[model samples]
Target: MAKELDLIEEFRDLSLVCEVTPRSVKLGMLKLTNSFLEKVKECQKRDRKLSEKLVLIDEGKEDDF
Candidate 1:
């Protein structure tokens, strides 16, 4: 009976640890995803600026002619 009780307690502890691990992993993944999204937004802003500059350059060349 004592051995059975010990086994049960161990199983419960293991279950709790398992539950906590997935939650931690999910939080880490969420943070990583957010960082990636921020980088994407930065790249989009840079691309927009580059496109605007290109347009200005093209307009200046037309005026030169």
Candidate 2:
């Protein structure tokens, strides 16, 4: 909307208080960062689980050696 764009243009140069609910920048950043961290941790857990399965498979193959 034009109103939204106007607001963005208005605040494109102001840096006043930094801890008000109206200043959603920090809250949005925190939410996004937390979401990213959760995804990274989930990916790492999946990777480690896959690696463990691969190691188990490799051990089985070695037992057949």
Candidate 3:
């Protein structure tokens, strides 16, 4: 839960790659980087179905409020 990305931190890293997620993805984490994480993050921000469940949970919070 605490691992979720905040909007400010999310947008701050508009160019995050897969390696950047080692802390989150863990051992067998599929390597995503550059446009991959960028697009995925974008989708995670805008599109529901395309985003990961964790990202979805983060995006769903009203912390910005």
Sort all candidates by lDDT, best to worst: 2, 1, 3
Number of clashes recorded per candidate: 0, 0, 2
Per-residue lDDT for 21-61 in model 1, tens only?
Answer: 42232112122248888998888778976667767778885
Writing each residue's lDDT as its tens digit, candidate 2 over 3-63 gives 8556655554354333324534331222224788888878877797666776777888534
Go through the candidates in order and give each one's C-alpha lDDT: 0.55, 0.56, 0.52
lDDT of 3 by residue, 8-50 (tens): 3564455433232635532233355598878877776876554
Angstrom error of the Cα, residue 6, model 1: value is: 24
Model 3 is weakest, by summed lDDT over 10 consecutive residues, at: 18-27
Q: Which residues of candidate 2, in runs, are more than 4 Å off?
A: 1-33, 48-65
Q: Report the Cα lDDT for residue 40, model 1.
A: 86
Model 3: CA > 4 A from native: 1-33, 48-65
RMSD of 3: 19.2
State the lDDT at 43 in candidate 3: 70
Runs off by more than 4 Å, candidate 1: 1-33, 48-65
In the order shown, the candidates' Cα RMSDs to the true structure are 12.1, 10.3, 19.2
TM-score of each: 0.24, 0.24, 0.23
